[model samples]
Target: MPKSKKRAKAAPASKAAAAQTGLSRRSVLGGGAIGSALVLGGGFWGISSFRTYAAEHDLSRVGDGTLAVVQIHDPQCPTCTALQKQTRRALRALDGCGLTYLVADIKTPEGAAFARRFNAPHVTLLLFDGQGGLHRRVQGLQQAAALEEVFSAHKAALT
Candidate 1:
């Protein structure tokens, strides 16, 4: 066999031995990748936090009862449309749970105007109990599964 070929093969074996004895290239690389990702993610989040958007309505209630969602939605808002679909699906999933879903219309200028009077412009989603105790508030659109989990998590207080 050629010396060069033998040396090339031996190189990998030496690396393997080095790994077995102490630190490996794979472990070091993995740690570096994780560290860099964490830093990048933190920086992105920090910058995002500084950007403020228009506030929505507030959903509030009080009670230790069934799962109830009060959504004050404006028909013209893109986010409101998305939440309508998701809320419908979520309510369907929690069928037998005696969940109450309320969709207060805030579609037109008059609707939006009315909603604003009720603090509807500051919030999108709200979960309340029987006694009208405010449990959860979701600013943006929430998925069906996520809504279910929220209710399930508070099942003890529900029933």
Candidate 2:
């Protein structure tokens, strides 16, 4: 009878090592891919929502005027926050303007109809020159100087 060759025994796997490798593989190939897809999906949705907001509004109410200001804003929008901050500073510099700021929530469909009349975007800043006239409407995120210029453009109506 021919002698059979003995096979080498395999080393036992370490529980910790197996667990770590399993998790790493899942993260790199499985969950990681899903996570990336979710991020891209969210980004696309956000941009589309912004476009819809822009289209739904008329913005006729934001023309040159001398009245309290009304702003249709999306709090989730960073540009809106920045615009609001800058407009507030400008308003403070000009006294007796009697600008009453009415911040309207219009980031969603329910508020879209009301916001449409204002013709403002998802993020916007508007100033009413205390004379029942709209002086300026600013859209998007802008630097302090640019924002100041927008306020300055309506300097005649500041008082």
Candidate 3:
């Protein structure tokens, strides 16, 4: 019968040298995974943060001679929240349409006064032309497609 030979273990010095090279399989793979996760998480966080920041514009700037879509929003209103989401989706469809989005948050004095100026309530969308003219006022929740069509037409008419 032939005797089988045992595999030789790597020396501790060689192991240290291998780690110092910084190209070992375990180090490469582990570092790559952690790096990838950090990049992905950072991108996601940045996008979400930007969206949240852009969602709320200065209410006082609504009629600042810019074509804008202002939403009379009450945070407690479910319909208002739904309309806000729908508006965002609609804007995506109308990208480059040159319409600034603003929120008339009813919780603030300025927002409340602005809403009262137009006698608009929560869940209302007030479309203003470039000269701050109230071109259209839509109440209640609307579909993204409809909002897109309306926004596109308004954009075309003004420009």
Candidate 4:
């Protein structure tokens, strides 16, 4: 009779070896949750950082020989935040166009007075001529292109 070969059995995993086999499912899930929380927290922080309301002094000073773009808005209003971002982009695009950008918090006393002076409700953009006369009063959020066109028109009218 022919002798049969015996099969070798595999060794079981040791505790240290099993532990070094990379992150477990629970560990990976926990890490992901922590990462997500951190990212979300950072995002909220970033957005909040930009949520500044205009001071009273900011509304009082209007530059001469420049197109004054006064933005009157409430700090807590989402519409105001959206308009603020857009307005910043529009102003940057109109840089060197002899334009002065001003922001006002509608909730402040000075801001309320200014708003009443212009009869603006909220999220208003007031364009002023070089002589500080109201050229255009746009209520609500306006497109950057529209703002640019308005600025150009006012600039032409001023010169």
Question: Of the candidates numbered 1 and 3, which has the greater TM-score value?
Answer: 3
Per-candidate clashes come to 16, 12, 0, 0
**Against the unseen true structure, what C-alpha lDDT does each candidate score?**
0.67, 0.60, 0.86, 0.76
Question: TM-score for each prediction?
Answer: 0.48, 0.44, 0.67, 0.61
Candidate 3 lDDT by residue in tens digits, 24-86: 878879999999999999999999988766566576566677789999999899999999999
Candidate 2, residue 59: Cα displacement in angstroms equals: 14
Deviation in Å, model 2, residue 21 alpha carbon: 55
User: Per-residue alpha-carbon lDDT of model 2 for 1-159, expressed as tens digits?
Assistant: 123222222222444565767755556688878999999999999999887656434343334353555556777877777766766676666655544455656765645664676576666666666444555676676665675555655654565
Worst 10 residues of 3 by lDDT: 1-10
Best by TM-score: 3
lDDT of 1 by residue, 1-159 (tens): 699999999999989998788767888799899999999999988776554111122223223354567677767778888887887787678776676666556654644664575465533776667877667667777787987787666655667
Question: 1 or 3, which is superior by lDDT?
Answer: 3
Q: Candidate 4: where is the Cα deviation over 4 Å? A: 1-57
Q: Give the runs in model 3 whose Cα sits over 4 Å from its true position.
A: 1-55
Model 2 stretches with alpha carbons more than 4 Å out: 1-66, 107-111, 129-135, 155-159
Higher-ranked by TM-score: 2 or 4: 4
Which scores better on lDDT, 3 or 4?
3
